[model samples]
Target: MSRDAASRPARERLLDAAGELFYESGIAATGVDAVLARARVSPATLYAHFSGKDGLVAANLERRFRQWRDVWDEVLDERTDPVDRLLSVFDAVVRYRAVEGNRRGCAFLAAAVELPPGHPGRQWLAADSRLLTERLHDLAEAAGAGDPTGIADGLLALYDGALARLARQAATPGLDTGDPLHRARRMAADWLAGRVPPGRPSG
Candidate 1:
């Protein structure tokens, strides 16, 4: 791993640098040279620890996934009710997005759009999707929803849609929109209560 790639601190430093860049900037927009420059490591060092840019991206994603999982678990842990645990997912999302100067949207979803299906980082993105939806599924099952699967799918869709809209600053031509995240959270709550939010007509 570039001679000292086996060193714990060096590897961490490299990863930290890559993580910052990858999250703040699009993965494809960020290059190995930029990462190396930021990490203050040589090409051999990064290559030794990771195969290349894709490898670094995958590793960075793994770290991000762990961070997100921990947050999700914490948010759910604070709520005793099954329904609260499910709703807390959206709470956590909003909290993360509210962080100062952090406009970078869902890193996994962003990467999913950029990375092809065969890319190594794509696995992490797929895992992310599965973990999120599975958590919702578990919560729905605990809450005894008759259509737990459908609810889970719908909630996940709303969550991702919010992230996408937030990424683009809610900007769309010929369409007026309020805060996308606010609407998503409200809609999730309504769904949890077996109702639909106002203006979103029920079929």
Candidate 2:
């Protein structure tokens, strides 16, 4: 970091550095020294603000969750129709990914996959995703799906599948592909139209 960059508050600087490095390089690959170097903070400053590297990683994930929610909530708020709100959720990801240059895919998904099993950060990712699905369930119910939870499940699949493949789609041009989001939207519309079975539980 330059002298001017070093002048920022330590915590903010640490988060900013972690965000960039963790996204650019996987979290495991990024070490505390790299983040400290970018933030131009001493080890004591980092340890003071965060529990340690693990805490810093957790903080970065939480920061990303808030950023995503802010964008998604703003779009959802604009949309009053329950079905439109559900579709807006998917569109929010599309729009945000575009702003991200469609690189790096979903940060939460990335973090979850990259983190070792039994990691608290992995659970944090799951919890955040569950909250999103619950919101989807509310919309699916209001939109009159025979099985709102089932609809939420279907849409959640579409949401994650599209996100997981976007980078690949952009990379592989000869895959006879169409817009993933458009496909997901159409499939979601199928669920709403009762063309696609909701596959609700029988128990």
Candidate 3:
């Protein structure tokens, strides 16, 4: 089928359904049949677009990356101050988390853990992480951080740690859960204000 004429709507519908189901329920637990049923498409139509469940999963991951990039671009556009722009990334994360029914942790990390290191999805995750890290580095440089790469690494670490903590807290009740994004924002702002030392370069 041609790219333009292919069952694009069905494909997108499948991707949307997969993202919702896979994130809410574990990817391993969601089957292709369920995805097709949710998308209201037959197995034949789905197969024409994707190789199988794996292909669908990869497509869903790519869709998420696109969504994230779009949001990041919008946030960056809203802030002219580089420091605020950099911190806006965390703000986006917090806003996303605050949305109802957002129980899934990092989708890329979840997919990577489910698949082996050499899996195609793992490869995509690695590439996506590198691109994100580079973007953060560039943003840090623009923000006048003393060491762009080191600051980028520090910010990434903080983000990953915050996400991990949030996921854990989401699982437990009455845990005195603090807002990771706010904590991260305060840390980033302090660093920007020169109150704390910039992180050392990783060897």
Candidate 4:
């Protein structure tokens, strides 16, 4: 039987295995052999589903992007206020951090840095980041911001910085850094109130 025919669910199995391994262990550290072994599939099976390791990495990144979109959609769906919708993104991140086994940094971001510049996964990362920024811009416009693009970019920068800080602080055990989302929300409120610049303000 052909590899595809032999492994009826090869594609899904490969994706699931890759996601688990890639997220737990950095992409550079996880090799094709390790993925194949975890999935209990032969090299030919993997090749049949994905052209190569790059293809597999692309698929994994796409899967993660989809997952992130779904999570945002679920959280933002019930929010009618655009400003609340915009701030809710940070809320979701904070809630995610509170969850058990919640790693501080984003898996997609980690993978994107590890992958080569021309890699397919890099395209996915770029697209995903754009999607997020656009969504935030829409919210900012709805919230009556004079410059939605600028406001959205500022919010994105804050979100990224908070995530980075949270990850760095994760090294300490049982130490809660309070709620980064709350801090983000207060910061957004200040920006909206004209008390602070949308981006980092001068001291």
Candidate 5:
């Protein structure tokens, strides 16, 4: 931890340390001792703030979800057109990645994959997924889709695929991950314009 970081509250430092480590390294792969060392906090301090590693994991996931939500909401708020508002999610991602320094992909998706069904972190994961699904449904309805549920689901699938592609690109060397989010957004716009059907074959 830097001197500036060392000046922060123990909980804040711990969460920052845990968030970076858990996202950059898999949650299972990153141990609590690593987080403690990174934060420059003692085991007792971590326990005092988070109760344990599970609580810290849940806190970090919740923080990530809130960060994403705030970015998405800011982008959406800047648009007036319904379609523009819906598509602003891609714009939000551009800003989010820049601001968060997130190169791997979706943190919520990672947590969902890493944590088990009964894990505490699963609640935040479920909340993040639910927010995406419900918000997309609302946005699709606003955009005058014939079937909001179907449109929302299709868009959700596109978003998830984009995130997975990003992760794959980050993991592989010399991989040609050609603008997955942009491609997804274009497909969405085409579908909305009736230029293409959902699940159209890719050339």
Candidate 6:
């Protein structure tokens, strides 16, 4: 480890190492030894801070959820149009991915695929899904959609589809496909406008 990395707290260093490695490679593919080697901390230190690899995985998911929420909150705060605010989740994803240098896809979704049925990491994935579904429902209602649940679920599907496309793009960089998030947002906007009434806040 470099002098700068060495100076940081063990927990932070461990998380930094684990987050990158788990996201870049499959979580199941990344071993605790790899995280320890990258963090330059003893196995005892890792246990003291996070119990084990499962705990560390949970911690990473929680941290990612917080970051995602903060980014989405910022996007909502910046926009006032009801339609724009409703569609801001996509915008938040765009900004978050760029800032975090994440090219694969949604971390929570990735974790969901890798973690076993009863793993604690699944809680954070559920929490992330709840936030998207509940917030989109609320925003859709505020945007004057006749069927808030339907609209919210529709957008949620689009969001998931975009993330899948993102993973494909990352896997094949030369595919020449455009931004999935942008395309998803545009589709949402167009669909929302049609769903919302004439006098209401249409896209």
Top candidate (TM-score): 6
lDDT order, best first, reads 6, 5, 2, 4, 1, 3
Superposed Cα deviation of residue 28, candidate 2 (Å): 0.8
lDDT of 5 by residue, 1-203 (tens): 67888999989999999989998899999999899899998999988887698999999988888988999999987877777766777788878999998888788888878898788888888888888889878877666667878877887888889888989988988997597889989987776776223443222
**Cα lDDT of all candidates, in order?**
0.75, 0.78, 0.74, 0.75, 0.83, 0.90
Cα lDDT of model 1 by residue, 1-203, tens digit: 34455444756877877877877777888888888887777888887898888888888888878777777787777787666676777887766656424564577877878898798887788788889888888777677677778878988888888888776763345444676778998888876775222232111
* Candidate 4: stretches off by over 4 Å: 1-8, 94-101, 171-176, 194-203
Residue-wise C-alpha lDDT for candidate 2, range 31-52, written one tens digit per residue:
9999999898899999999899
Clash count list over all predictions: 0, 0, 0, 0, 0, 0
RMSD value for candidate 4: 6.4
- Runs off by more than 4 Å, candidate 3: 1-8, 97-101, 195-203
Tens digit of per-residue lDDT, candidate 6, span 3-71: 998899999999999999999997999999999999999999999999799999999999999999999
36-149 per-residue lDDT for model 3 (tens digits) = 777888999888998888888878888777777777777777777666766777877766556424764677777876876565566568777986799888877766667888
For candidate 2, give the lDDT.
Answer: 0.78
Worst 10 residues of 3 by lDDT: 194-203
**In model 1, which residue pairs have backbone atoms overlapping below 3 Å?**
none
Where does candidate 5 clash, by residue pair? none
Q: Which 10 successive residues of model 5 have the least lDDT summed?
A: 194-203
Candidate 6 Cα deviation (angstroms), residue 174: 2.1
Top lDDT: which candidate number?
6
What does the lDDT read for residue 136 in candidate 3? 84
Give TM per candidate: 0.82, 0.83, 0.83, 0.81, 0.92, 0.95
lDDT: worst 10-residue window of model 6:
194-203
Q: What is the lDDT of candidate 5?
A: 0.83
Q: List the residue pairs that clash in candidate 4.
A: none
CA RMSD of each candidate after superposition: 6.4, 4.9, 5.8, 6.4, 5.0, 1.9
- The true-structure Cα RMSD of candidate 5 reads 5.0
